[model samples]
Target: MPLALYLLALAVFAMGTSEFMLAGLVPDIASDLDVSVGTAGALTSAYAIGMIVGAPLVAAFARNWPTRTSLLSFILAFAAAHAVGALTPDFPVLFATRVVAALANAGFLAVTLTTAATLVSPDRKGRALAVLLSGTTTATVAGVPGGAVFGTLFGWRATFWTVAALCLPAALGVLKGISAGLVQEHAADGPASHTELATDGPALRTELAQLARPRLILVMLLGALVNAATFAGFTFLAPVVTDAAGLGELWVPVALVLFGVGAFTGVTVAGRLSDRHPGPVIAVAGPLLLIGWPALALLAAEPVALLTLVFVQGALSFALGSTLITRVLYEAAGAPTMAGSYATTALNMGAAVGPLLAATTLGTAAGTLGPLWSSGLLIAAALLIALPLRTTISTGRGIEVPR
Candidate 1:
């Protein structure tokens, strides 16, 4: 609800656009760089791998830095990486830039989430996080499609330049907004200026120990499995829509837009509900996916049914994702940034794994329908892993369990 929170969202929008726009540019990049489509596609994997490996490392290294300082540094690095990417003449340079961009993106997201949580009251943390994450959903709705259109009209390099141009304003906004917010807080609190910020040494060690607990590990696993469930079906949505659902190639964009709308709606709903009843929201969302996927597989040939199911499935999947993120933040209270970094790491791992699983399934006799079923099973497993959180909350031990 603060201006700085919205500014953070703007920064996220810039990063998310760069991250997702690669999907649309793969063909152009492959042709331009004289490589196979699959090789150019490896750029996406490089970014994910960078996020998975870079998040924890960046979090640890920035442990002693002020929140605003870390955020500004990361955003600037991300902008510079995009600038390099826009001018690169070969695939190797482009791939290296992707890795650097992802590293900066990971650090920016982790710090931003932690900073957003500190800006609000404990009771409103979930809603604040949802507001921050809405940038990614918004990117899916507008940025990716806009980039694709731009790339189609101009060239792929032009799209990268556009992304680089967007990042400059976001970085400047973050610099101005966070500085003002911190200065205002300092004026209000006097000598207790660092109260809302993370400390180093002993505190860091304790938070690391807390992060390693079995219950928290389960929570991280749940986050990963839930993501796997969503991406397993989503990564191959084009084929599923055309081959399995018997829809035309033209319908794929329509289905994607519907899914994006649903995702935006879901995040909005989760923002309101998660602050009050995260457990129940996640409980319902997982089951919705569990039920929706099988029905999707069965009714793929029905155009009307497939359209409706895709929207609902997207809504449920994102709703569950936002709730899981909030839960991880709650469970890892002392080290919010590191917790967020770990959550991002888990989600990236799942993003990588889900596509592989879906691709393998496509190669089997089950074909496209296999991904839908596989997603359902993964969600079911995630639900089972989530059971302990419900039990902890019901027993009024949620606060104690994390410590």
Candidate 2:
């Protein structure tokens, strides 16, 4: 709702574009660098690894700095990394640059999410998070496709240059929109303010201990499982549509566009509902995915049915996603920055694992249908884990911890 929050979303858009654009340019990168496509694909893995390892580390290192300062610093570094990536001559250099870029992206995301939560009232945290995350969904719909087109026309390096250029505006937005004094005010008003913990050793330790609670741990696991379930089917969506659903190759892009539209819609709906009823929203999201997947496997042979199911699946997954992030913040209401970093790490882990699981399934007799069924069972397990926790839906002052 605040100008600062939208600025943070803009920053996320730049980062999300850089993160996903590589998926579209892998073939070009492999050929340019004189490596196998598999090796170039490892660049994606390298970036995910950096995100998982870098988020908490950066959050800890920047714990003492003002939120605005950390965010700007990270984005500057992210922009610089892309510049280097565009100029790199060899695969090794490009791979290392990818890691650096990912670290910067992870740091930026952790600080931005915490800052966004602080900018809004407690009841609006879920909606705020959805607004920030919309950047990623938008990237999938627009930026990735744009990058692919740019890479095809110019060169892969040109796409990286464009990503670098995008970050400049985001950096300027953070500089102009967020101020040191505003950061202090928002932190003071927030449910979990890191400003006080940054200087107090004992308070920081207590905050870390709160994050280690069994309830919080369960929520993190659920976050990982939910993402894994979503990605499992998504990683091989093209094959599923073509082979399993008996659709033409031409239909793959159409299906993806439909899914992206559904995702945007889902985030919008979830943001509004989560502000009032996060617990109930989360409870339904997983089960809906559970039901949707099996139905997809059964009905995918029909084009209209397949397209309808894909859209629904996208909507359900993203709706669950926003709530999962909100749930983590509620559980770790005393350490929002650390909680956000942990949530990012958990989600990245799932993103890496899901594709592997799907690939293995595709190798089996079950083929493409394996991902749909597997994802359903995984969501079912996640729902069972999540249903028992008592989440703080809303509080007048901030999210309240259950005693």
Candidate 3:
């Protein structure tokens, strides 16, 4: 709605392009760098590892700074890293640059959510945060596909260069449009004292204190596990469509576009549903995943069913994604920024663990059915983890979701 939010969306679009373009460019990167495809695949894994490691690292260290300063610095670093990625000759150096860009991207998203959450009144918090996240979702539709086409038309280097160039303008737009008022709202809630943070931070002593409440830990772990399940299938959906569904290669991008369309629609609707009834919305997402997986699995022979399931799964996953983030923020009300950071860390952890499991299963099994089964089982496990969360929430918020 606001110009600033739109600018933040632009920033997110560029960041999304930079982060996800690797999947499309992997074969080229491997060819250019003289590495195996498996080795090139590690670039995606490395980015996940970087985000997981960077989220809290940046939050813990940068918690005291103004949001604008923190966000701008991270954006600049993100742009610079991509530029270097466009030029790096050594594989290791290029890999490191990608990681640096990932760290910057991770840091930016966490801060962006915090910033966005504080932009509006408590009642609109979910909606505001959803709008910011939409940028990332949009990138799946627009940026990554565009990058893939650019990579094909020119080269992988050209794709990186394009992203880097886009980032510069995005950075300028963010600076011009970002409000001091929004920045101040975020800064207003400073980190808790050292004693509180000690009980909260991820130290040997803090783990016991934080985990003493079963409900909070339940929320966090379930959130992470569901995310892991979501990505397990998500990481390879395009290939699955073409290879398993017997859809022609040309349909891969179209299916992804549909997937993104479903996701965008799901996220907006989920935010509204969560606003009206958070608990029920949260409970429903996992089962939807369970149901959708069966339809998706039939893709080995039933192409039409697989295509339909892909859209259904994408919608359900993203809708619940907003609910999960809001839940985590609510659970960690004492530490919004830290909670935001931890939520992202959970996503990154999920991103890492899910794909690893999917890859392992797909690698070992006889057919595409392996990953489909594995993903379904994992989603069931994640749902079981979420069962206890209903008992934890108090209804007093009435969808108001206090800041």
Q: What is the C-alpha lDDT of each candidate?
A: 0.78, 0.78, 0.72
Off by over 4 Å in 1: 180-202, 393-403
**Model 1, residue 293: C-alpha shift (Å):** 1.0
- TM-score of model number 1: 0.92
What lDDT score is found at residue 183 in candidate 2?
A: 48
For model 2, residues 56-112, the per-residue Cα lDDT tens digits are: 888878866777688889998988888998998889999999999999988888777
The clash numbers for all candidates, in the given order, read 0, 0, 0
What lDDT is obtained when candidate 1 is compared to the true structure?
0.78
Model 3 steric clash pairs? none
Ranking according to lDDT, highest score first: 2, 1, 3
Tens-digit lDDT track of model 1 for 226-267: 888888887778887889777888888778777777887888
Clashing residue pairs, candidate 2?
Answer: none
TM-score of 2: 0.92
Query: In model 3, where do residues sit more than 4 Å from their true spots?
Result: 179-213, 364-366, 393-403
lDDT of 3 at 58: 82
Query: lDDT score, residue 365, model 3?
Result: 52
RMSD values for the candidates in order, in angstroms, are 3.3, 3.2, 4.8
Model 2 spans with C-alpha error above 4 angstroms? 181-203, 390-403
